[model samples]
Target: MAEYEAKFTELSGFVPEFVNTEEKKARRFQLATKSFISRNFSNKLNLNVVPLREVLQVEIANREIIPVNQVHHRCKLKLEGKAFEVDLIPFVLGKFNMVIEMDWLSSNGVQIDCKKKKVRIRVQDGKEIMFKGQRKTHKFLTMFQTKNLLKKGNESYLAYVMDTKKEIPDIQDIPVVNEFEDVFPKDLPGFPPDREI
Candidate 1:
């Protein structure tokens, strides 16, 4: 997916709210597709989305026509502090959570700045808001890459772990603790079984 995204020299990264829930989870929207939500995701979220009576035939890159039947009407999406209502069709898009098509963006007068990685959207009041894309610190290993590496059996892999907790300095290292070395000693004598500190 990263490889395909990199092929296009356009600004990427758009996340909008899909449903009204306590957690307020946001779904990723692909700029390429015709506004769609994954069928599995819809079911998992218990969106209770219903299928349209008329199935739409969607042509893919391979010239295959896929019938889309499910539609979630009037889905509220919040972007840059503004709310927009849109209808989303459910489809089986493997890694993609959802997609916001170019039609919606163009119709809404949204501007994309690839160089700056920003999206500009004009509200009803004619006020323009800029949303910046978060910079990627490192390229994440894709599922395909992981599968291939594991198949090789002798491949070297690196895992990156992030720690969010702030580290606290040792109590004995504090300036005030230096004045009370006897109370807070660097090395304390072992306490007896019944002794309490």
Candidate 2:
């Protein structure tokens, strides 16, 4: 355990805390309760849990997604009311989504807002880092393109399509006609006034 702590501290820059079995059991029970509540009442009650990955599968559809093991492990750092500087790295992960990393500081703290899909970190030196995870659909041809890159291709090919099809409208906004001229009189309440008269 001492060697593990030394290595963890060396790699993470934070000394790990050793929790007793009773404390571990209590934390696990709390997490389980929160998970149950979030799963059953998230949409209806707007309840959120911490570390979003716990309740949702956060990853790209086709690309490799980095695991949250590091973030989860580092989040255990706690220096209450201490000002700190965070080393945050924002990168594009699967699809158009973003993942933030902060593992270069000691005695850092992290807060995860599952409802907002955001992570907030407090490091040494009175600094705070906050970021949101991105989840946007893209065209199949443009899936790999990011804000820094541009690509030209078939825009119809979708990288991610809606899970459900759009419902067909019962009434059409425009009247179906053979020609534009035919559409005018039938489609409009009255012939469009010329010059607003």
The TM-score leader among the candidates is: 1
lDDT of 2 at 74: 21
Error of 1 at 145 (Å): 5.7
Per-residue lDDT of 81 in model 1:
74
Best by lDDT: 1
- TM-score, per-candidate, Cα-based: 0.50, 0.22
TM-score of predicted structure 2? 0.22
* 105-192: candidate 1 lDDT, tens digit per residue: 8888999999999999988999998989998675677888788868879577577986769676687667887678678766767884
Query: Per-residue lDDT of 1-197 in model 2, one digit per residue for the tens?
Result: 99998876676544334322565456444433221211222234332223443332223334333333112212222335544332211223324222223233222467888899987776556577787988877654343554235444433433676657776433344356333554445356865568854
Q: For model 1, what is the C-alpha lDDT against the true structure?
A: 0.72
| RMSD of candidate 2 to true structure, Å | 19.9
